[model samples]
Target: MMGNVDIFEMMANRYDTPERIQISKATADAIRKYLVDTHDKNAIDFGCGTGLVGMNLLNDFNSMLFLDPSQKMIEQIKQKIDDFNIRNADTLCFDFEKESRTNLQADYIFMAQVLLHINDVELVLSRLYDILNVGGHLLIVDFNKNDEIVSDKVHNGFDQNNLTELMTKIGYREIQSKTFYFGSKLFMNHDASLFILDSRR
Candidate 1:
């Protein structure tokens, strides 16, 4: 297991890199199209590294809790959002790996590039399900098994069939997934997929 401090620092640096920035932008745009079309103002961003996804959510939300396990990552996010003068967000350095919904809840819970590292996807899904209000949604953007290159590493990428089965077993219904591009043509044409699930089932 990575120490909290090291994980934060690593993610802080990772978020600052150009590759991550590009990927974050694509992920954010896809999320907006998928979940923010209805535009609920209350949301939570789990593993919100550098607030990349949170920043994009700002246009569609009034209140958002940005949660992560790394103080360094949160600090970087604070600086990034502060540089742009965004203040309607809250930060919590809680490790979902070790913590549950004991302290927070939201209408929409979003996580980008975070689920691949989760060893207990079902347990985490259950926890998120507990915190989400009725009619709430959970949106996860991560690498999919179709990405032939990075699929081997970096992400525990899943095929749509497997993901649907996994979420169904966890009591999440209306599970859907779609693929999208990241970076320029140099990257895989379909490098990522966004999985959306409604907690009410």
Candidate 2:
């Protein structure tokens, strides 16, 4: 079976299609609603492939880190950052689930359309919780459960209630979750909706 990193590396060059940009825009907009004027804050975009979502939100933070498992994806994001003359952002290629590459800390950690790709969701969430500074926020954007979507590698989707319970178990507080966007044929050609869940560590 092809690992997630290899799969993403192969798709890196062609990953930023029009459809994807649209989806990212929607996700970013939803995230923006919950954001405050934190010009001095730092953020990390975990599983930040090509930085479509993270790049759009760079102005919201003082500095941003784009972290992905695929080297090619990180390369693409670096190119985008340079091409746009975005000085506040940097890119790193690391598989957070398997190893720790940097001892960086952040006030905010954003994950958009990333949870569905993770197999051990609880473990990943726990790791994220540990890296977040006290009172830091973890913002997650992922699809709501859809029975119509089936896959061997990706999760079918997520149940917000179950996910909230897991987040609580991981020591998060002030958890707030809501469905933010809906699209037709969004997930594996099945009609699906996306949700944004924000929690403080």
Top model number, TM-score? 2
Tens-digit lDDT track for model 2 on 66-86?
A: 999899999999889888898
Please report how far candidate 2 places residue 2 from its true position, in Å: 8.5
> What overall lDDT goes with each candidate model?
0.70, 0.88
Give one digit per residue, the lDDT tens place, for model 1 in 145-174: 554555332454657678778778877777
Q: For model 2, which pairs clash?
A: none
lDDT for position 145 in model 1: 57
Tell me how many residue pairs clash in candidate 2. Answer: 0
Per-model TM against the reference: 0.81, 0.96
Clashing pairs in 1: none
- TM-score, candidate 2, is 0.96
Model number with the top lDDT: 2
Overall local distance difference test of candidate 2: 0.88
